[model samples]
Each structure stands twice: as structure tokens, then as C-alpha cells.
Target: AVVSFTGVAVAVVSFTSIGVAVVSFSDGSVTVVSFSGVPVAVSFSRISVVAVSFNDIAVVVVSFASIGVAVVSFSDGSV
Candidate 1:
């Protein structure tokens, strides 16, 4: 996951093959996670809340609050 933010404020999280998350704002919060597997990328810009969860062969991205972004990618031997 990849998160990029450039502004008054910024936040970023990366989980390698797991995922990435980025947030930016007066105040921002970002979260990225890869569970039981490896996720790809979760991204956010000028965001407030970013959440993600991934398991074998799955990906998820979620955003919350005013401005937020989330991305997740995962792969296990099998789904």
C-alpha cells in the first residue's frame, strides 16, 4: 500500500506487500494492515481516517472522516 500526503498535515503507513495508507489535513489519521497474508497497497491523501484489512487472496480499502483513504492487498497460497 502506498500513501502520500502534502499539505498542512500528513500521515502515511506502508505494509510492503501488505498494504499502504496515507492521510493529510489539519489533522489526519491513517491505518494499514495485512492479516494472515501479504497485502498490496492502501493509499490516502488529505484524509482523516484510513483503515484496511487483508487476508489470503483479498484486498480491502476503507476511508473515514472528512478526508480519508485506505487500500489493502493480500495473497495466500489459496483463498
Candidate 2:
């Protein structure tokens, strides 16, 4: 489902099989959220990409006018 609020968007997807969850923005970023699970992506002023590889998952939050990038990752050290 694609939710458009103002000029932003909130896209949500549900899965029933084993797979990977990826999220990408229009700026120039990509992201993966889960493997064989539900994924949620949100966009603001910049593009953010989240990806899930192996048992590891990555999260990134960036701003358009900011100078800082917040990166959070979780994995079993196999990524």
C-alpha cells in the first residue's frame, strides 16, 4: 500500500513467503528491512536505503539539509 501524506509517502508491504525486504527513496538511496517479513519505508526530503542481507539488517536515516547520517545495523556477524 502506498500512502501519500502531503508531499511525502509511506509504503507498506506484507509477505507470506521467505524473502528479503528492501526500501528505496527517490533521492539516491536504498534500504532493506526484513527477510521474509513485512517492510516499511518512509520518505522525507532525502533518500534512504535499508537492506537486509543474510541475518543482518541495516537502517539509515538521512536529512536533506542536515550534515549527519544515522546508520544502525544488526546482524549475526555474517554480513
Candidate 3:
């Protein structure tokens, strides 16, 4: 696992053949997971709740999950 902790604001985690996780320290939390340069998922975190979504079609929001493994909603809507 290649972890780059830039600072107290940004953190990046990348693993070959796996997905990447980016954490934002800002009040508004945003997460992005990509595959082959395509953004497949996103998480809009509001406090203790993180809203997972799929492709831009949802831009798409319609699921509830957590930091660990989850049946996350694919941006492509392949939940």
C-alpha cells in the first residue's frame, strides 16, 4: 500500500490493481474512487453520515454505507 499523508488536510492511499481513497480534512467531506481513469464512485460525507453514489448520472446518490466494505453504489449505477 502506498500511502502519502501530505499533511493534516489531505491524505492519499493507492494500491496497484485496487482503487484509490482520498480524504479531505475540510468541513465538507468528499471521497472519490476511480478505475482506469474513470470515476466510478463518490462519497459525500456529512458528519457521521456518508452518502455513497455512482456515475455522474446519479452524479448519482441512492445508498447508505460506511468507511469499511460496503455495497457501495457504483457511479455507473451498477449497485
Candidate 1's C-alpha runs over 4 A off are 8-55, 62-64, 72-79
When summed lDDT is taken over every stretch of 10 residues in candidate 1, the lowest stretch is 70-79
Clashes of 1: 14
Q: In candidate 3, what are the lDDT values of residues 45-74, reduced to their tens digit?
A: 421222332332222222323333222233
Put down candidate 1 lDDT per residue, 1-79, tens digits, no spaces: 3344554343333334544332333354534343445433444443333243443234444343344444332333221
Candidate number that wins on lDDT, 1 or 3: 1
Q: What's the count of clashing pairs in each model shown? A: 14, 9, 4
TM-score each candidate: 0.28, 0.29, 0.22
Tell me the deviation in Å of residue 5 in model 2. 2.3
Model 3: residues >4 Å from true position, as ranges?
A: 1-8, 12-17, 37-79
Q: Tens digit of lDDT per residue, candidate 2, span 1-79?
A: 2223344434332222344444444444555455533344455455454433333343222332243434433333221
The residue-level lDDT of candidate 1 at 59 comes to 40
